[model samples]
Target: MGRPPCCDKVGVKKGPWTPEEDIILVSYIQEHGPGNWRSVPTNTGLLRCSKSCRLRWTNYLRPGIKRGNFTPHEEGMIIHLQALLGNRWAAIASYLPQRTDNDIKNYWNTHLKKRMKKFQTALDSSLVSNSSSSSQLLSKSQNDMNSTSLRSCSTYASSTENISKLLEGWMKASPKATTLKKDQEKEKPSNENTNVVGTASSQFTQTKVEEGECGVISHEELENFFSFENLNSMAWEKSSTDSTPQGSLSSLNDRFGTMTEVKERSSNRPAYCFSDKWILDEESGQVEDLMDLSLDCCSAPIF
Candidate 1:
């Protein structure tokens, strides 16, 4: 009955090998130098069959064995070698020294086989399409060829127009461009104050440029544009006007503009003064004021 197996299947272990078992196997092979699998189980007292022990050593436990995904060159070599060697995986493994026969066989069946099938189908489809198109082209007359060329040109022009319109619409509707436009509009007045500074810098830069057309720019004038004094003034203005605790809502609303509009609106608002009303209790002979003294935008006190 199949030569009664190698090490008796009754007590032999199956499935994946453990790290400890792998270490034991590797250590024994390092000392003994592989081969003679029949005595390996007996000598090491391992629960594996002789065949299992041999496979574990050759496939995994081997010192120079490489793991992980195969490279493109390795894949191509496997495919070509398989074609030449057929299903002789041991022969293929001999060429790829780092890979085991089992690994090559498994990879071929799982990955390479499907890839080759897809390649073959794709090649067949391309050939069929080429043949049909070529036949149609050959059968077409000179007039039909001219008409086809004219139609293609028209379609290409139409496509170009559509693409141009789409690009124009995209540019106009772009959020970044819209935001930049709004920011530019908002900063127009602020920038107006900076234009005098920019003009002076520009004139100085132009004079420097005229003096040394090929030389490096002097950075002295540019430094003045970003001077600490200018930066301090800008910071002070922003902090005092924009972030001031005493500033009214109108001041906050007109932050982008000069404070003139805020001052004007505040001055035009009518002053308000609230008075207290008293209730007389005839039975108790007492008078109670029901309202609190209040004033809004009024210089005079309300009592």
Candidate 2:
């Protein structure tokens, strides 16, 4: 049999910590610095066990610990690290300066993991379809752009202008915790209203040879850029939480008057289709799903 447990439960205080206890723990650590856990309660005059004291301090009361939502870049990093390190929270926390091991663990369990399980079936089909047809789909987007005129629509924003603006918006906007329509309308930057729809000479046209140009878009490149595809064989589940992808995709065929297609299918939901022209009349805002949808880049309000 194992040795007796470290502390007796008979008189030990338990449950949520009190303000007085928190103050005592803080004072002791500040006075003498954090050392052995077994000594914290003895020296600090608190009723919590050493283990409890240590956990409380490390996970909650620790200085500089950021308690809030994780940013997209940070979320991407966490997903990448977790893939590499498994569930090693401490190892994962090292890369995130302000987050604790407990915090990252909790976030993974409560938010991302559950969503991945929910969408596993749909993602299996989307992943295969998208990975194989990336080039063809993009070529179609280019052809459509050439044949179509610049049009603006919202409810079904399939026009070339709408696609460009929406793609640009995702590239430029900050990652939000909420995707509600009202909040997004208020948050959209007014300066971004410049029409991105134009010929190959359009400012949005991208070139790899140019310094600022992102060149063409590719899932292979994005897979590498994201650096965490395995997701423990749940690789099917991409970045669903904190859906902020870095940089932006430039049409690889920008030199050929082409624009790239947005993956309409997210692990979260069905994707929207973007082609050169809208099926609707010039002024109509309603969108009809076109042929061959892939990933869904959060576009302008499709209300």
lDDT of 2 by residue, 102-147 (tens): 8778776765455444445334454556545445444544343333
Cand. 2 Cα-lDDT: 0.43
Best model number under TM-score:
2
* Candidate number achieving the greatest lDDT relative to the actual structure: 1
TM-score of each: 0.42, 0.45
Instruction: Please give the range of 10 consecutive residues that has the lowest summed lDDT in model 1.
Output: 273-282
lDDT of each: 0.44, 0.43
Q: Where in model 2 is the C-alpha error above 4 Å?
A: 127-303
